[model samples]
Target: MRTGIRQTDVLIVGAGPTGLALGIDLARHGVDALVVERGGTLTPGSRGKGLQPRTMEVYEDLGVLDEILAAGGPYPVGMIWQDGRQAGEHRMFDPAEDGEEGSRFTGPWMVPQWRNQEILRARLEQLGGSLSFGREVTGIEQDADGVTAHFATGEPVRARYAVAADGGRSAVRRALNIGMTGETVDPDPLLVADVRIAGLERTWWHVFPPAGEGAGFLALCPLAGTEDFQLVAQFPDGTDLEPLLTLDGVRKVVADRTHLAAEAVTEVGWSSNFRPRAALADRFREGRVFLAGDAAHVHSPAGGQGLNTSVQDAYNLGWKLGAVLGGRAPESLLDTYEEERRPNAAAMLGLSTAIHRDEARRGAKTRQLGLNYRESSLSEETRPAPGEIRAGDRMPDLTVDGVRLFDRLRGPEWAVVELEDGVFLVRPDGYVGWAGDSTEGLEGYRARVGA
Candidate 1:
């Protein structure tokens, strides 16, 4: 590794799913990207596991569907729960056919965040790319010509553009003096544990909400690599967890909530605390340094939209950045990244806050699949009324012909989809820029996209 200086067309900080997804997208266009990560290596934590249909489409296009499917778990049987008395149950989404256009992923995928990184790392190596770990970025200084980044250990790297995919504690954003607004919706602490729950052989995490002011809510979700369940419980608003966070205390909650026998108790592997955060940065880009994923936005793990949306954010921006780096489009095209992705991030933040307030969603959310962006520059040509705007709101998971689209088209690039009645242009980031009843010679469309 060169410590004095390094250079690449697009310098990406953080090799998490978002940064890695962006790297693959750039490589597909043959654009050179240098990825820097502050973490020593891939951290072994099964953080987020839900991959939405739109995100699957982006990943399939990037050529890593098989890996995801292999690593992820079985499709859940939706969710089953009621307010207090176990409200019956219902299927989350129709797995039979995905009706959405411009998207390839049908439902949600349950894979650990680390496993997602492992697959992306392998794919990066396959594409003749490399990553530098333990390269914590300390500051980012950008000029009219390019941007220079300084790390704690190395000299600096100059690039045409830089993206900050760093986690919630992003230094790039702070160094650039970016303002972020939003805070923890629940100031109280919740115990989050990832372990294989014994004696459970089926899908669907058994859940039990807290009883009253002194009780705690139980969140039992599935995980990858075993029959274990990810359990989360809310402690009293200001109660001290120092006494009741051990294996015995957590097991008592699980046993009481699910009514499982004592023999069903299993070993606790990993345990931690989580404070659901619902926040978004004031802006996604400042001069040459841009933000993505948690760096740009942070929200509760509700609706499983955080990771999926983050991946889509990178996918949407990657090609646009590559196009500019390769000189295919004017540098002004990069401005569209913030223009398009910021509003969508705000929407996710709002929805996630709602979910955190009340955790009841079982699986993939159909509403999340249908977010609309009529005000974006990417959709000026194919303007449609709110009634006419469907694909722009949500990418349907339906398959048109004999081929399955969702499994086939999730990669790190844009997918221009042609629906039965209209045509919708889907960016790799999983947002619909242009959608209308007809995509006839696309004269106006080409002029709008400037392609």
Candidate 2:
């Protein structure tokens, strides 16, 4: 390493779920990567608390599923309150059927965003990955060779590739002059805080609907595996939000909306205010630098899609980067990162916006199990008669030769499985990349993928 410059195969900007998860994935593949964060520590608060099933699967592959399961629990039933009395029970998400075969997790899990990042960072470090805090990326420049990222306080970092996992107002994306197109899902700003309430039960998500005109709805959902409850209140449009971020202001809002008194709030840990919005970057790539997570797309929190989509963005990019940097795949293989992820991100943005507006419910669609890359240029389906599982679809967990399928697909390698005498090439990300009755096209596909 030079005096003021560091070198790595991949430079990941931002240490949120996206960047940390990408670091873990790349590390498991034996790739030398560095994750840099602008902040001094992992983010706090119960932001983006829900982990969808697809993301749970991704965690399993990244070797952190056990920690995630132990640190979080399932979403509780919603308890509706009226005039300080229990009005009725409301189900936040549509009831899902029993977990289907090959599906281990069918519902969303609730874990505070802070805890989730802790687990990801721990796993990344355990895998020999490197992360440095307080490394603020001021701007980044990329050429045909590599990317050079200049920070505010340290020597610049140079890498063969760079990714912006920064948030919606991504500084890296702006540095590349990428544009975001989006709309506000709601005019009213929402107040979300992590606080401890004296008498609130932890078994149910408490809901307080508006009692009269000019009043807003309030919901206090207990953050699983923690003592604090996440308070969410919708304010009238154009209302000033500066006061609501304080402890007294939160107590006042709780007292006014629900039956709770101002004295019931014991402690306030973190708070934030934001108007719900959904947006996507015009492009996911610029030269050797690419955008993932919030930098690539921003979603309303209604359907818990933001964080999950962001993690999946990292998962989708990780294997491709490993393949290219390791000299296993063609440089052009990197193009598929944007081609496969951008459209999916746009669709998720629409789904999140719809759910925020009550046009869609959190159920089958929000689970994200059915999301795939069937149309990607890398997806090759040469079978004369495709079965229930096709190329580009998520490879379901199954048992073969008394061994688990996902266990076989684990780690950083492509897998080939024979089902009904048909050959299936599973990508490292757990998607079926190619399917055929024989090895007719497997070698050609492998050559292209550097598998």
Q: Which candidate is the best by TM-score?
A: 2
Per-residue accuracy of model 1 over 130-238 as CA lDDT, tens digit each: 6889899877888888899988997688888899998788888888888899988887787877765676655665666565667776767777665667777787667
**Model 1 / residue 403 / CA error / Å:** 6.8
Error of 2 at 349 (Å): 0.8
lDDT of 2 by residue, 402-426 (tens): 9988888888899999998479999
Minimum summed lDDT over a 10-residue window in model 1 is located at 359-368
Best by lDDT: 2
lDDT of 1 at 200: 68
Per-candidate TM-scores read 0.83, 0.98
lDDT of 1 at 326: 66
Alpha-carbon shift of residue 270 in model 2 (angstroms): 0.2
